[model samples]
Target: MRSEAASPILAFHEELASDIRTGLAGPGQKMIPSRYLYDDLGSALFDAISFLPEYGLTRADERILRTHARDIVGRLPGPITVAELGSGSGRKTRWILEAIARRGSTTYYPIDISRAALTRCALELGQLPSVRVEPIERDYLRGLSEVAARRGKSDRLLLLFLGSTIGNFEPAQARDFIREVGERLKPGDGFLLGTDLLKPVPTLLAAYDDPLGVTAAFNLNLLMHLNRDLDADFDPGSFAHEARWSAAERRIEMHLVVRRAHTVTIRGLDMRIRFEERETIWTESSYKVEREDTARLAKHGGFDCLSQWVDREWPFAESLLLRR
Candidate 1:
């Protein structure tokens, strides 16, 4: 068991305790924070999810980056800082960094929660000529805030928040997050956002509930983490993974359904959690955004849509937002 006080990433264990205990033991529907789903194993599982044939998100975004890397880099002025939020693995970011290098040497800040991921990204990116990769080991907003404080007004920037990660936040949360980010960024700074657009229900569903079962493993890994950290007795095998589209909400929700009524105790939290047969613990929501919706969201976030790139086949987009 890792000590929460010792590990920066695991420091949120207390917060996880409160959320899971309250969410599982509270009234009505139960819920858990999707953020907790990214343990080392979960992160690896997600990487596998990216490669699954049914999952077109990674491929779609890569296509955009490959096709328009130069065009995207052209929008931002040189002697700039390229900061990426949640830059896990930094595979797609290689495209942008290559483009940035063509213009000139610039500072690269890759912010991510997993220090392991950040280290790997830095090592790979630092090898690029004239480019310095400094990674901030922190969450999204906090990392951006830190960058804003140190950077000067004259510093040009191109902030990248790719991977349709914004889709994870609820609409209101997304709006607030983007707005806060905009306040920290100066005018003329560019925000590149990759969003999974509203597509056919079947395609969206398949992406989350892939036939390869990678998504299922990813969903179940959350329980494994909870059991390990919280001293909870959770039989991950006893839970069934489920992914479905909430048409009204325009999002796909993933859940772990109880296979049988049972009680489990988290010794660390000193709580006994009970689940009725068929009860579900809602885990994640990926909200799909339309092009018009993305434009409106940028406006709410104090940005104007400068350009938008859509995948040729899939209804996925990479939109450039300029802070106004």
Candidate 2:
């Protein structure tokens, strides 16, 4: 059963079908928007991926939030309203919300593309005594804008972009995204940004392509997602998940490589695509950054870095930035 929410899912059937047709029929590398990877099953698979031993990103994020949530909240002025972009599961959000709730009542807006994710987030965080859980089922920017519109004159907005989801964007896109986020904020509003730091190639590779193949399953599930949602005939077995590190881009790329040549049809779109053996459909990219990069990113977004907490064990950074 689909759960109800204030905001409807933005990626409706027509928009999704259009995106799929454009991405698959494009001249360059065949691809699908990484956002499509988070259908109900994909979101659950990702939750599982976070628990894999090799994937320490989520643990690192939780550690930083737990240790510094108070300090992060303290840096902001009174009457803070929390809004988190891509608030998956939102299990790690307890630290920040608890910190805010300690002071007084607050409203928490968890914006996500997946209805299932928003539903789960509401269930997980709705129990906070002083925090009201409001789930918005929309893409990041649009959802943030809606939150911005609802902000009270005296409420300080603390935008949480945790889980290193920003790494999924290209460098330029990331900067632009941050800047756009700042546009929706008044001076003194806060932005908590999470970024995975640059680490050894082997460690990074292992994190994306875990030994137990949970990550592989997570990546492969995208095809299953498309098949189920779009009435597409994608052979999940015809392709293998591949994770590669791009030295120049400083990013880990997830791809679905075709194992054998075949043609797949999207009955809904009435389109057919021919896949050549070894051909790859680029799915997602996660760009690792240096410690200093966080501050630079904050500055680029018209925000000042108030504080940055690093997790030594995993080399992850949670930077607190103030809109300027």
Steric clashes per prediction: 0, 0
Tell me the tens digit of each residue's lDDT in model 1 across 156-274: 88999998999999999999999999998998899999999998999988999988789999999999999898888899978999998999999999999999999988888888878
Per-candidate local distance difference test: 0.88, 0.90
Error of 2 at 15 (Å): 3.4
TM-score of each: 0.94, 0.95
Per-residue lDDT, model 2, residue 297, is 85
Q: Quote the positional error of residue 1 for candidate 1 in Å.
A: 18
Best by TM-score: 2
Error of 2 at 282 (Å): 0.4
